[model samples]
Target: MVLVTGIVYKQVKEQTCGISFHRDTLYDPIVISRIRPDGLFASSSLAVGMQVLTVNNVPVDDMTSSEALQLIKDTVGQVSIVAENRTIAVAEAVCVNAAPLVPESRQKRGFIILKQVEKSYSFHGPMTHDMVNLINNNLRQLKLVHGANMLQFSLNSSGHFYGATNNAAQRVHEEDFIVIILETMELLGWCLKVQYDRSPGGWQKELFVFHRMSE
Candidate 1:
């Protein structure tokens, strides 16, 4: 569970919170389904897919969507919320034989962590297209594409944008972070901050944090 705190300010005199929620059923937790890039909740740590657990110290795990909405509406200025950061794990076998083979074992596993940020993505790489294709293909096999039309990845080394391409000499050592950008019709743009790592046994695992990007 994660604690997210932010002020709920009115934008353009509209009472809308600039955030939307969804509940599959009364038994299910309320999940953040959509968020505006410039909305009140956008500046906070909240992100899509996070399950809303409590609103202003009131637990809404078992409440209906209307009940949860009321709790949020009752707030005057600052709002405090507790949510769950759900992680999706992809098994190693899913991409054992993926293309652009490396010398090490191809066995790998990963987790997707959804979160939000803002950035531009016009950097060019000699092999950027190939890298994007490889990652998207893996995402498709995991059934996590979710309508994302394009994906671009680059290495973030000490705050600088470094393209993660298919060059044989280029290496992503342990503790390196990769910035992944996803574009779609619905959400427009999203960013995935990935930390690449390798286990002592040579197994690879990537931790992906998803973020909503502003234009």
Candidate 2:
């Protein structure tokens, strides 16, 4: 993982017990260097050496990384991301693979994670015990979503995860494709949104399914 430097930090304050309190602050924005091949991390057009200073043309200095990520999620079509200290804009692109898993039906259920920023995709078919173990094993190495029984994990190549859909996360296999899941306030980093056609059967009527990726 490539760490972008030049991050500035300061301190903030609070009041309690008729006294004032201050705490050191940490503000660092997450930028993508690559995308997870089979996960919600989709293909991006952002080139190497590009420093992201803003999202959708908004300067990021005053906003938190999460906030900047959300701004990216809300935009579409050649969304702008600036270089770290440069005044020029960088290129932005995204791509998704096909998925092997079929939409759930009968008693089966399906889940996905969406990037409110670029709306990129990664789809998963079924979660197995072994897959869960593998994801847990590499949790620390993973950029964004990691841990157990993840219904959905969203992150760009840069490794920023904002929220989860089901909250029950499952580990993903190297070949399994998965979808991006999300909503308005809880935009999952810098992807726009998950877009896919629906299957004819399975799943709850109120829910929608997208083909995130394929192995």
Candidate whose lDDT is highest? 1
Off by over 4 Å in 1: 1-3, 6-14, 88-215
Residue 42 of model 2: what lDDT? Answer: 28
Q: Please, what is the TM-score per model?
A: 0.38, 0.26
Worst 10 residues of 1 by lDDT: 168-177
The most accurate candidate by TM-score is 1
Tell me the tens digit of each residue's lDDT in model 2 across 175-207. 111212211111211222233333245421112
- Tell me the TM-score of model 2: 0.26
Q: What is the lDDT of residue 208 in candidate 1?
A: 37
What do the candidate models score in CA lDDT, each in turn?
Answer: 0.42, 0.30
TM-score of 1: 0.38
lDDT of 1 by residue, 1-215 (tens): 45555556543321446555555456566766545554568788876667788887788878865567656655666566677766422221011111233222332223224221222222222222443445445433321122322223444554322333221111211101121122111122223333222233543323334333332
Tell me how candidate 2 scores on lDDT: 0.30
